[model samples]
Target: MLTMNDLKIDTVIVLDGEPFVVQTTQHVQMGRGGAILRTKLKNLISGNVLEKTFKSGDKIELAELSRTKANFLYKEGVNFHFMDNQSFEQFILSQDQIGEISNYVKDESDVEILNFKERPLAVNLPPKVDLKVTSAPPGVRGNTARGNVTKPAVLETGHTVQVPLFVEVGDLVRINTETGEYVERA
Candidate 1:
């Protein structure tokens, strides 16, 4: 059990029989009333978001969450597979559970999988990923003066991201996985 005062971003807690991950949390104190906690939470299994407020002393159930580093193996249709580095055991996850992280993950890439009561709920990718540009328009030499214009580029993994205009096919670039934005030329 945990109290609202102890809530932190990324903490997993059970509410109304559903596991929710804390997305954002803030402590608030009313001028004439007691303290409260304002939080934005995301449902682990359903991907639904909710805004909630709790009194500072309110008690909440702490979810049974486990995290492990795993190597992504492959994807078969709607299921993505991963191998646990420690146990060498493999687990398969549904696309909905992985959410947007699936878009930036490459085969055999290292990732952290979060499980709630032994059920996979989320996938965490590294902050930055290096990928090759599979397709991009040829860069015009005089385009440099335009100050960092961007063009859509397809990656080897089939993810499309906006890259600087100077980028071209076969060029390697670093991408911010969280935002799916181009970070820099690699």
Candidate 2:
């Protein structure tokens, strides 16, 4: 059990028998009445979001979650496939559940799968990943007039990211998965 004060971003709580991860939280204070907590929660099972509010002194139930190593196999249609490292069991997560993380993942990469009640709910990627630039337009001169000079480059994973003008095709670049931005050459 946890109090309203314990609610914060990334906190997992059980509500209506479903596990939800807190995406955002805010504290509100009334002039003379009690305080309250406002939160946006994402459902771990269905990938749905809900906004909820709780008053001060409210008790909440925390959800138990686990993580396991898995290998990303490939994507078939709208589903992303993975194989458990230990058990060799294969599973798939839809694009909806994967959200934007799909843009950062590479084939045959290792990742952590979040599990609840033995069910895989989501994928966790490393903060940074090295991917080869499969395609990039030639950098032209005189583009430096702008404060920042960058061009869109297509990665091996089929994701496009802005890179410095010096970047070219066949170059291995490090990307920040969280921000989907180019970090540096690998």
Q: Which is the leading candidate under lDDT?
A: 2
- Choose the strongest candidate by TM-score: 2
CA lDDT, every model vs. true structure: 0.88, 0.93
Model 2 local distance difference test score: 0.93
Which pairs clash inside model 1?
none
How badly does each model clash, as a count of residue pairs? Answer: 0, 0
The 10-residue segment of model 1 with minimum total lDDT is 139-148
Residue-wise C-alpha lDDT for candidate 2, range 69-164, written one tens digit per residue: 999999998999999999999999999888888998889999999888899988999999999999998988788887669999999989999999
Misplaced by over 4 Å in model 2 are: none
For model 1, the local distance difference test gives: 0.88
Models 1 onward score TM values of: 0.82, 0.95
TM-score of 1: 0.82
